[model samples]
Target: MDAHRKQRQAQHPSLTITDMYNVLEKLRSGEALSAKEQKTHEQGLVSILLQLHTELDAAVAAAYGWPANLPEEEILERLVALNKERAAEEARGLVRWLRPEYQNPQGTQQTEIGLSTKTKVAKATAKETLAWPKTLSEQAQAVQRALQLHERPATAEDLLYQFKPVAKPQQGQRLQQIDSLLQTLHGLGLLRKTELEQYVK
Candidate 1:
């Protein structure tokens, strides 16, 4: 089973467990599937893979101290709650570092540095939240700042959520504006666009 999973992952590195879950749900609902999804279904792999997906989800949920069969909405709610709890703990200088060796290499000294860094990051995040730039150039710089802070490639929509528009445009117009800003940054060689259409510095 592990070998099969590794093989599948190698073949489709971008295929996520959530994608498989959605495909299975669509199948159960008799909804029309996309061409790729239809092909997977025709290959008779959906049911087989879905069983593995379920087992994986159950194991993950158990590790998180959650029920094995939580609905997606409930899972999201729990995640948000946990995130808030962690944030509060962090504010109180209690950090649960995922990688102590890498994040705090110099022992107690590094831990102090990490806490100080987290405090600065928290302040920066609070200041940036819902505070959109007024000019296009400022917005471009803001995007760069956001990318650096996240330390990962982001979709335009992901970056869009980081700020509130100074003047609310229609949804479609707002998306176009964001795309244009990304293109401007790309042309200026300030950012790079991935094959997945995400932007990074």
Candidate 2:
């Protein structure tokens, strides 16, 4: 792991992984880092990591047959569309099992599960509502889309309502997830926070 980190660091000579970790440790422990430490953190690993992540995202988008430079709203929209398409395929008995050996077993035909009228209605409703994305990157993009649609600064609660109905039991967890994503988006400069603790793109 250290060697891999060093190789990545070598790709961006200005970034110092050690200094970044030191600064992060200080901040996480509620200790203030000096001006120099702060500067190192800003100019070091964080910037390099962001650049690397951008490249990775572009590559993944290309692999998905999507435009690499798509905006956050478009990315989330495309993802949602793809998800619905997959669900529709599954409804028609086309199950694309990732681990066929474990999921389908040998020589066993996959059975088509018939959907009831009520279940189909529920699914149609779900298709109209955006679900929380499973991956952190996509979740961040969803937050960005929410902010764009809001057209004004929005509190986390305001953004949460844009997604699919969260169960009462999961509301707290979902709120925390939104808060973390908000902080991450703010740190990446994809979002800005108002004095009132609202987020805007």
Candidate 3:
């Protein structure tokens, strides 16, 4: 039975609140995490965040004693808003930027949400294929260092300074790749985004 449980946990990482908190602390401390561990952490964190957002889902909400009937969007909004408040109140970190991907189109693209930005957002180049940080781990390391130096969660905007020199993204490509890389790192658990934004590990 123990072996079976271990196997199951190996297949599906635990999603308990304690597990979530541990991962958060690990990321907050900028500990080194393997790609696989990072992925697991990302999945667990997202599950916890989404679970908390599913206010109407009894099974998920029951854990937090959150009332049902609140919409997912509202819950998500509340989480992001609260993080912003906490960051400002405690100097914990900055929020992620959720760009309006659909502003030019008529709902053709997903609306940017739950992302973060820095005090100033650097723009991606208008034209360029891409370049820089050859591997995910390399990128992740950069962000982690940035977080430690900054002593706060890092936004893509903030990470730009840390990675751009290494990437040497030419004038044409500019900040495009860094932005996408930040998202990738967030997805891989090398980095994290609060409800709607990405922050460095």
lDDT of 2 by residue, 1-201 (tens): 244457656775776767777765665567876988767656654445545456456435523445568988988897788688779987997875543445767736543221222211122232244678776556655666666566679988887887888789999999887886776656544456777998865
CA lDDT, every model vs. true structure? 0.59, 0.62, 0.46
TM-score of each: 0.39, 0.39, 0.27
Candidate 1's displacement at residue 140, Å, is: 45
For TM-score, candidate 2 versus 3, the one ahead is: 2
Residue 168, candidate 1: how far off, in angstroms? Answer: 68
Per-model clash counts, in order, read 0, 0, 12
1-201: candidate 1 lDDT, tens digit per residue: 345545656677765555666778997688999997775554435677666556555434533445677888999998888788779887998766443445656554322112224222122353465456564444544655665555678877776667665455565666666676666556544466788998865
Q: How accurate is candidate 2 locally (lDDT)?
A: 0.62
Sort the candidates on TM-score, descending order: 1, 2, 3
Better of 1 and 3 by lDDT: 1
* Model 2 weakest lDDT span, ten residues long: 114-123
